[model samples]
Target: MKKLLLLLFSFALFGLWSERNVQSVHASTIASERLYRLYNPNSGEHFYTKARLEKQQLVALGWQDEGTGWYAPVTGEAVYRLYNPNAGDHHYTLSAGEKEALVAKGWRYEGVGWYSAPSNADYAKPLYRAYNPNALAGSHNYTLNKAEQTYLTSLGWQDEAIAWYGVNLPSPLIVDLSEWQSPSKIDYDTLANQIDGAIVRVYTGYRADNNYQRHLTELQKRGVPVAVYAYVAPSDTLAEINAQATQFYHLASSFQPKFYWLDVEDEYLSGGLTDGTSIRDAMESYRLTLATNGASKIGAYIANNRFATFNLDTTKFQAIWVPTYGDNSGYYENNAPDSTENFALHQYTSTARLKGYDGSLDLNRLSGQVSFAQLFS
Candidate 1:
């Protein structure tokens, strides 16, 4: 009887301890949920998930949440919150203007915000909006129109004159050497001497391998500014493109280019990766890498066709080089509707004569539409 009683007591104690442990775990989970809830104490609003917070509805109103479920920072009358999975039960707040701006840029705010789950669980990562560097009517576009004309007038530009004059306009010209039949044969010294200041070109492995370094060295010797170009090929996979970018990064570091151009044109369209989402993703990744690698200060070169298809965030890139060639009038049509804010460097003549090149190559002149500082600085 004694032995049986002792055994029963032990069993009861074990059960009680187990029950308490279970209760403690349940309580901890409940507390954690509350602690992690996206709350803005300042705004007196709380969000259960990140999806709820990122909604276009919320973003437009300028809602922001503090990660601690504390007070949210408010701008105007709105408050915002964003759930961060990496933060583990933390919420972040967005200003009202930020929300409105995001919505205006075309972000779909929907779904449960974010929650902590098992590491193995699959969760949708947040998608960032695309960056369109060349918007039809932005301040840069407006400046391009006035600056180019002013510079042209200063350079003794006549209505029918085909003379080239140097105005020290401080803007880089958008040039493509792809059409150059014999880049190797051309005298780098002659071309460098003709162009004042910097002469930017699209540099690729194909071009870089074909005596690009030697040509760049020659251009440098002539005291002309040099920039390299990276063509984002459509046929290239993201991995391949990224690897290419890494190569460019090393080269840019060594060359110390004034700027780098992301040339997305024929090569991009010719290959299969034309889907908007894929293009956007690749662009974002590339941009992020550039930014991370301290190459964000560089510029981007885009043609009319790619400009129309991909929505680029102008804020991410420094300047836009647009190609629109035409008659002697020096006016060319852009794919997008005409606006004062269009392009910084406009390729008005593709068949312009160069001293060394046998055939006409894609020639572009600096448009005084905007000050270089306004477009780049």
Candidate 2:
């Protein structure tokens, strides 16, 4: 009887141990994200991302992923990422003052790279930063390892102290961009942390936006969902409108973007064209052509209060994105879309001077019941 009781006690202890261990592992997985680190030997730049694919692709491109980095939590404060266009270097910080100073000095804001662990929290780890005074492209390196930090300083790298703590990630908003952002060499990795998804201008009329390819490539590489839009030009006939759709789709097909949108924002499609029938007819043609070409989804981007004027059959589209800048105030969330007409995405501001890119960005949000997964997938 004594031996049997002892055996039962042992089983109880083992079960408790197993349950705790399982809970610990599960908590870690659900509560944190890994910030992958990579080093570019050619550029002498050390890069970090919460994006696994971006890290993997860079490794394939000769950037070395030499094992490990730290895990970021599911929630924390912001650490701003900035890129120097002239110097081709990048910097991260938690100070809005420093970020603004850098922007004033011409460093393009790359948005929040990652959230930092709370400074006041005891469980937080330190991310040591070092600067190489001579390097042009990758002048700074950040690491969570104390030994590596000490070693860099021993080699004469200027120790910048803890640049910021890294703890987490999520995507909540959308932005539409064009050549206006100067896309060729911007920091998409850091910018990716800020946006849930993106809608990029593929072309403005017959002329392709120079930024589309690089924008789509970098954003996709960072695992951000992308959609493409074309600013419509006045079409002389249905054939021209159909050609526009075909051309945009062909240009956009390789990327397999989330959505294709006809951006009808100007009065150029007006003059002689009636928005009710003629323009609607052209828009319908563009929408149908895009769909027939295998676009996963189709949307219409129209000016605020212009949806009814377009006389578009709203039921035909998968989504409708409307730009409604209350006063073009260059601020976001200060005002919502004025027209209560049908719209899935609200482009709230054209002058959203967000930190990620140097120029003003067009900020947007999903309306009603729209969500990131539903829109992108």
Question: For each candidate, C-alpha RMSD in Å?
Answer: 30.0, 20.4
Could you estimate the TM-score for every candidate? 0.46, 0.55
* Candidate 1, run of 10 with poorest lDDT: 26-35
Candidate 2 per-residue C-alpha lDDT over 137-242 given as tens digits, one digit per residue, 9 for 90 to 100: 8888888778998998999899999976543222256778788788643567666765668888887777888888999999999888998899888867777788
Write down the lDDT of every candidate, Cα atoms only.
0.43, 0.71
Q: Mind giving the per-residue lDDT tens digits that candidate 1 earns over 287-340?
A: 667666767565566666665466555456766777654321211222232433
lDDT of 2 at 50: 73
TM-score of 1: 0.46
The list of candidate 2 runs beyond 4 A from truth reads: 1-171, 271-277, 327-330
